[model samples]
Target: MAEIKKIGVFTSGGDAPGMNACIRAVVRTAIYMGKEVVGIQQGYQGMIDKKFVPMDARSVRNIIQMGGTVLKTARCMDFRTPEGRAFAYKNLKEEGIDALVPIGGDGTFTGAEFLSREFDIPVVCVPGTIDNDLYGSDYTLGYDTATNTVIDAIDKIRDTAASHDRLFFVEVMGRDSGCIALHAGIAGGAEAILLPEKETAIDELIEKLEQSAEKKTSSIVIIAEGDKNGGAYNVAKRVKEKFNFYDIKVTILGHLQRGGSPSSFDRVLGGRLGYAAVKSLLAGENRKMVGLRNNKVELTDLHEAIHNHTFKLEEDLLEMANILSI
Candidate 1:
């Protein structure tokens, strides 16, 4: 085990609400442990560009409550190439950083894995995506906040939906995963939810809406962006063609779900995951991810964390959503 004297931390992929909180945790934890911390700006691109900033407890002060990463984030096509990774590693060596704590989703972890294996660097990761689709962690950092944001929007939309007796198609994020759509749909009391995980036929959806129309003055159907019949716009178009009796409205939540003061749950979760990530690296752990599983912090092999696809939506929750809609 190499003695890790300095650690580098960065946030990548889509910016999540509690990422700043996680950044605060990483910086403070590393400082307290008598090690130096460097903030890598714009993620892997920062390494290739040599964008490094010295960080201390003061540098991360007053940022725990902030949304988005203070370190910033960007998608780096350059990081995917071997020559790009070599340049990144060279920059890391020049900066005296021997270990890393990266906070992001699978794409971020994949890059970290490549860099670590190629350069023999030590790494520990914190799951920090709003998608919450990562396998090892039960809940990713900003997922709670993102869902809360969706619910809040749903509540407001319901008001207008009821006022005009309209059928609304509200679309939320989740291209490959439906975690946000499933969770927020249930909490917001939508009439039906279309998920990427489940192929919801248009006829079946209309059947439910017809059932809803008989008893309710207003209806809200939550749709994941990756739903098989296409996004909210196409689904609404098809539904409007046949079910034209009710006035319809389509709302794409877009990136709105990605920004917010993280919920209380997320703030604490970020802190815990960040603290755990640094501790794991200090304890000579390498190429592992720190995650919260079943309310306990646990470590999973980074390869498993990146490649495994076992995360599933709760069956009971799915049933409950269906039953409660009526």
Candidate 2:
């Protein structure tokens, strides 16, 4: 590959906390390496529409604490087509963007892989989704902040639930992954948790709630969005049938879990991954995802990061969560 003189950076897929921090790191790191950085306003869509901005150290000042991406993000369906990708490439070449750094989740990496292979553009990805579903990185950028946000909501809900002796079914975001739900459920002292990875029949959930109700316990059941037994509303209705306490309530955290000031862990992780991504791109690495494993920066093949998912929480942690909840 030709020498990487200028690097283009963008954030894609869902907006995540600590994204701005990552953007800042990418800009500063690239600038420090004497490479000019171009900020793509909205991922591949921005590339196609020519939404580009020159970034320097001053441009990213004081954005590390921000909740969402300063570069913004979006799902560009058009980027899936060859014509759209060719257009994006034309725009990139026109803008003098020689290498690329994209921060995002699985879909983001898949797009990166496609573009890199098609055009031979050097690309490095930083895992920046709240889902934490990607295989290579143990922790994505926003997982900590989102987990903290859910626990904060759960703690507040606990106070009201205890007062009213209410059974609260709190739904958190984790489509196709239970990382958030499992972490928050264990931390928030939830009585039961429904995860997408584990299939729990409604009857079995009712049996657990029944046991709680018999003890006059004010319970909180954490439900992941992709739970096998539908969502929080459905789980609440089914549990209300047989396990009636003083009251029953369902609270869907929804997107609330996605927006918040980036936690210290997220900010640091974002900076690390972003810095490593630029370094990787400069090292002539292409179609690679930058991640932190065992507290050190590691690079994984973008194709494997997108296609091979072995993300699993400790089974013993789930077991201990159930035991401790009781």
Candidate 3:
């Protein structure tokens, strides 16, 4: 293992709620270990473009509770190519960054792995996405905050829904993974949750809404954007054909779920993951993801973490979402 001198860290892809906390932890933890830290802005693209910022203990102060990433984040397709990656590697070498901590979703990890293997740079990925779709980690960095944001919106929607006898189709973000939708749906007490992981027939959904409508004055159906049936607007349109709602409303929620002050759970989880990532790098661990499982930090091989990973919503929770809807 090369004597680690300085580490480079960045948050890529979509910005998440607790990313600032993680960045704060990484900066402070690395500095405490007598290592220098460099913050890369806008992720891999920043590396390629040499957008590096020197960081210290004071740099991360008062940022643990902030929403979004102080480090900023951007999707970089250029980093996927050999020419672009070579440029990124050259930039890292010039900055004397021996190891790296790239925080974000699986796509972020994929880019991190490529850069590490191609240039022999040490890396540890931190799951910082709100989707909570990663395989090894029990929870991703911003999932808790995102779910809370959704539930809060739903609660507000519920007030109006109750007053007007509205049928609300609330859409939450979850591209290819319904983890956020599933959790928030259950927590928000939706009439039904349409997840990408399961097939929810329109007829079945209408039947459920009809039943709920008969008993309650209003109804809520949570839909994951990745749902096979389509998004909230389409689902609401189809449902209106069969079910007559007093007032049908659609709430996209949009990027609001991606922005918020980190919840206590997310803030703490980000700290743990960031601290573990830096510690892992110090232990000569490379090309792995630092995740909390069963409340402890564990490492998973980057290859396995990226490739052979399958995300399934908790079956019991799925069952309860229906059972409790009644």
TM-score winner: 1
Residue 93 of model 3 has an lDDT of 95
lDDT of each: 0.94, 0.91, 0.91
The TM-scores of all predictions, comma-separated, are: 0.99, 0.98, 0.98
- The sequence of per-residue lDDT tens digits that candidate 1 reaches over residues 110-197 is 9999999998999999999899999888999999999999999999999999999999999999998999999999999999999999
* Weakest ten-residue segment in model 1 by summed lDDT: 240-249
- Compare candidates 1 and 2 on TM-score and give the better one: 1
Sort by lDDT, best first: what order? 1, 2, 3
lDDT by residue for model 2 (187-281), tens: 99998999999899988888777777777658999999999888999988877777665498999999998898999999999899999999988
Off by over 4 Å in 1: none
Q: Best lDDT goes to which candidate?
A: 1
State the local distance difference test value for candidate 2.
0.91
